[model samples]
Target: MSSYPPSVPPQSSAQQASQPTGLRQRLADLRGPAVPPRPLDARALAALAANPGCGRRALLDGAGVDKTVLAEALGSPAPFGQSQFAIVRGNSFEAKVKSDGGAELLRLVHAHLDPGGEAPGPDARVPDLSAAGPEGRAARTALALREATAAGAWTLLDHPMLALEVAGTPAYLEPDAVVVHPDGRWTVVEIKSFPMIDGAADAAKVGAAARQAAVYVLALERTAGKLPGARAGHTVLLVCPKDFSNLPTASPVDVRRERAVTRRQLERLTRVEELAAALPAGLGFGPERTAEERAAAVAAVEAAYAPECLAACELAFHCREKARAADEVTALGRSVRGELGALTTVEGALAAAAGPGAAEDPTAAALYRAALLRAEALEPVG
Candidate 1:
């Protein structure tokens, strides 16, 4: 999905100085004359960690280029669309969970994570996080958090805005909810519409929710770090519909591992400044630019294409086509790429396994043996 950067107030000098001179303008120029940097959500940002070597995703995302648009323009549109049923179901479930000043939400938090703790009273504060832009709302949320912590009350921040600096750009994030405990501890609440069948949810969905919540935990930790004695809980509340009904059941999902993975993945990202420096003299991805020009500009940067990228990245189709044309071994998978060593292409890998040097190379030797075993097995069947 394409989004323009929110109209945020001016940044402080410290924020400005975080970037080198001309970096922002250069990134803007790369995106095109009029395109706004597409705000990267936690989900998109987290996917980057999974594909660490994809320089194209990093640079395009850093520059805020709209990959959905870019992919369509390149004649390989991304097959991504949410069913209206899901959109409505998610919204309805979340609203039900947070209804009545988040009374139900507090109950679930108390029931799942802190069963021994006192339940929040009717007067539990649900902070109005409304503001002019993402930055303003994020600041407003931070202030509310501090006040709630100081007051030592149960506070629910509904849809709090957060900003995480990624690749020299601020990626704005909004979590489902952030709950402040009376004891100054904070918990992130992820409300999902997916039903927990027989008290068990889908593992993949749970994992995705955890990874997404990990990003919120990271953002919340930043806020907690500034306050004395205030700590963000490593365990997040994953609230889902129970047994296909609207009733919300909660589980305490430990996101410590996901958090560490995300943190490392984000850190491993190639800096936008370094990427911009490596670019050719003039390259632009503006909507007005010709399809060929835009494709060439995108091609100038390398992409680490994998089968999994098809699920997460808009440019997967285009990249997969390119990988196929080049016979890149990575198109099969990273595991295959690792086994091939210096043989980056399928033809090269086959050649290596058949060559005399196969005996000297461990990977080639293994492939050579595996090929023989497969051939023998198939011959008997024939």
Candidate 2:
């Protein structure tokens, strides 16, 4: 049900021969009958950066299958829901920041990123980027960015939608704002409702903001690469409330390290074209179909489940349910998986610790020794 343009660029004979003939058809089929693909946003892509080994997330995301619906059908819904209060507060804060044709936003960027550079005048270009859909808007934004960079003037793109290709699929991202400096460099801006008390915000929240901005930086760089002399700056500007008040405060967060990590993780994702080849025939992962069929189709793919997924992945609850039912050691955590070595199941670990094989493997022997020590300590003093 995605509004994807049907036509792809013509492929050469060698390229045609290299790929499976019906790769796109296979992907379309995977979405089930007439199911629209869920577009991956910057936040979702950032979550992927946190856990690269999650094949289930990669396949589900690449195929554009709605994981929230799938998770509910599996009877283990993801524990994620935004409160009305937070949503209203965030929207209000963002609107206030960009109220004056982004005059306030430009001021923040100038002060934080380039106070020494040219200051943006009242005539700074803030082009209207709204379009029919995400794809159209992204294309419009890219055009505006290129033109702005070429002119080498102070420009601000407010809520500009960007598209980044991940594992052969296009993921759309919309940053709060992006500033094009007079020197033909672009900077990502993140606006948050969290209070920056005493000129400092929570470290965890700041880290999350940096990761999200880094995704935008990556997308911008891809667009800028096509135009000569245009570059996307690695440092991002974060705007937040100051001391529980409505006033805004800005800080430049350097995301070079986060950008490198995200780039590596994105590259490591399994290619969708290759994953499609391995799927079973007539598989349907759509919510419109029967739950049993959807479950079976999803089960066909292997998943690397870990407790950390609970906080990030929408399918975490569903995967956790399956892993717990199977007593998978990875359901505990990644550290537990390493400690168990080849024993991937809880029963297997317990059996090995109690059996003769405990003495063979160092990991098993260590677990057995720790268990005995605990048992001895729990015994009554006699």
Candidate number achieving the greatest TM-score relative to the actual structure: 1
TM-score of each: 0.92, 0.88
Model 1, 137-219: lDDT tens digits are: 88899999999999999899988888788767677788888899888999999887778988889998898888888988888
Model 1 CA RMSD to the hidden true structure, in angstroms: 3.2
Q: Give candidate 2's error at residue 379 in angstroms.
A: 7.1
Candidate 1: pairs in clash = none
Q: What lDDT would each prediction earn against the true structure? A: 0.83, 0.81
Superposition-based RMSD of candidate 2 using all C-alpha atoms, in angstroms = 5.2
After superposing candidate 1, which stretches have Cα over 4 Å from the reference? 1-21, 376-382
Candidate 2: segments with Cα more than 4 A from true spot: 1-21, 369-382
Task: Give a tens-digit lDDT track for model 2, residues 1-382.
Answer: 0011212122212222333557655655777646656667777898887787777688788777778888888777887856767877888888888887888899999998899999988889999897766667778999999899888889999888887888877777778889999998899988888889999999988998998888999999899989898999999998999998999998889999999999999999888776766778877787667889888987888888888788778888888889999999998999989878888899988876675566688777877887788888999999
